[model samples]
Target: MKLDILAIGAHPDDVELSCAGTLIKETTKGKRVGVVDLTQGELGTRGNAETRTEEARQAAEIMGLAMRQNLKFRDGFFQNDEAHQLEIIKLIRKYQPEIVFCNAIHDRHIDHSKGSQLVGDACFLSGLRKIETIDDSKSQEVWRPKHVYHYIQWYDITPDVVVDISGYINQKVEAVKAYKTQFFDPTNKEPKTPISSQNFLDSVTYRARDLGRIIGVDHAEGFTVERYAAVDSIFDLI
Candidate 1:
């Protein structure tokens, strides 16, 4: 199904932790939003691929996503090449979302930057008619998103755009907590990891609030763009 916005991530929880508030805000306004995870996060220390998939489903339900799919790319070894780009291109053509959200341009995780470039390239190539792609053995039409935004992750980067998510931060928190195995859990006997700490879990909320305060909002999500965002009038921005 066509989507108004598509959020792509290197792993399952990336989108939720960074931009689920924006997704929730959009969905509440009757917009169709979807998610594409590049990997199952099988390589994570705390959860296996199977558990991560289930958690992703739960998060999707909480976020009210219209569709959620994984590309099954290798967790840490996926390359940014034609093969990878084609995979992303197929989904872009299928969804035809006007706006696309992807991983940060650069991050601590190698996969995040790789997935960022892969999705960005796919967005541009998907618009080329000569780049033939097929779905279900039938020829697919070329499609490209109008805008591609890279959401902040694990780093403090200046944002080109920030969306006010004042009333929807709780939804973001709930959606993130849906991945119970990946976040802080006193009952989890698994070995501790970078993201399994109480501080890490709390950072999610505090980060949003910090960004919000910069823009006179209660909560917000920040993103970087490939190009300057145009506005019709100065008053169009809040």
Candidate 2:
């Protein structure tokens, strides 16, 4: 099905940690939004691939997403080549979303940045009619989203735009908590990772609050753009 927005991340919880609040807010306004996880996060120290897939589903449900799909790329070794790009291009053409949210352009994890460039390149290639793709034995039409925004993750990158998500912050927290194995959990006996710390959990909330403070809001999500952001009217900027 066609979606208004498609949020893509390198791992399952990336979308939740970064842009789920914005997704929730948009979906609440009757927009059709979906998620595409590039990998199952199998490399994570805490959760296995099977567990992460289930957690991703629960998180998507918490955000009231229309759909969520996984590319099942290698957790840490996925490359940004023609083979991978074609796969992502197929989905972009299939969904034909107007806007696409992807991983941060640069982050602590190499995969995040790699996936970001991969999706960004796919977005452009998907628009080229010569780049043929097929689905279910039929030729697919070329489609490219008008805007591709990278969400902040891991490191602090100044955002070109901040989306006020004050009303949906609680929902974002809930959606993030759905990944019980990945984030802070007193009961989890697995080895602790950077994300498993309580501080990381708090950072997610406070980071939003901090971003919100910059624009005079209770909570907000930040994003970086590839090019100059355009609005139909100045009133749209806030």
Candidate 3:
């Protein structure tokens, strides 16, 4: 099905952690939203790929996503080459979304930046008529998203756009907590990682709260844009 927005990430929980509130806010308005996980996060310290897959599914349901696809690329070693771009281009053409949310432009994790550039490049390439992609044994038409937004992660990059997700922060938090293995859990004996801390989990809520404070909202999510966002009038922003 055609989507209104498609959020792509380097790992299973990335989208939920970064922009679940924004996505859920859109979905509540009857917009079709989806996710494309570039990897299964096989290399994670706490859980294996199988567990992450299940967690992704639960999170997708929590976020009310219309679709969730995993490209299954290597967890930490995926490249930003033509081959990878073509695969992402196929999804871009197939979904034909108007807005595409991708990994942070720059982040502490190497894969985040890599996936961000790869997906951004693919979005542009997918619009080229001669790129030639096929889905389900039929030729696919080229499609390009009008907007590409990079969700903030690990870093506090200022946002070009912030959406009021006042009523959706709890939903976002639930979706994020769906990844039981990755986030804070006192009972999880697998192993402790940088993200498996109480502070990290609390930060998610406090961060959104702080962003909302800047705009006079209860909660919000921020995204960086590839270009200057435009509106017909200044009041249109309000």
- lDDT, residue 208, model 3: 98
Which RMSD values do the candidates have, in order?
0.7, 0.7, 0.7
For every model in order, what is the number of clashing pairs? 0, 0, 0
What is the lDDT for 170 in model 1?
Answer: 87
What tens digits encode model 3's per-residue C-alpha lDDT throughout 129-230?
988999999999999999999999999999999989999999999999999999999988987888999999999999999999999999888999999889
Clashes of 3: 0
Per-residue lDDT tens digits of candidate 2, residues 1-238? Answer: 9999999999999999999999999999999999999999998999899999999999988899999999999999999999999999999999999999999999999999999999999999999999999998989999999999999999999999899999899999999999999999998999998899999999989999999999999999999999888889999876
Off by over 4 Å in 2: none
lDDT of the structure predicted as candidate 3:
0.95
Q: Give the per-residue lDDT of model 1 (tens digit) for 106-160.
A: 9999999999999999999999999999988988899988899999999999999
RMSD from true fold, candidate 1: 0.7
lDDT of each: 0.95, 0.95, 0.95
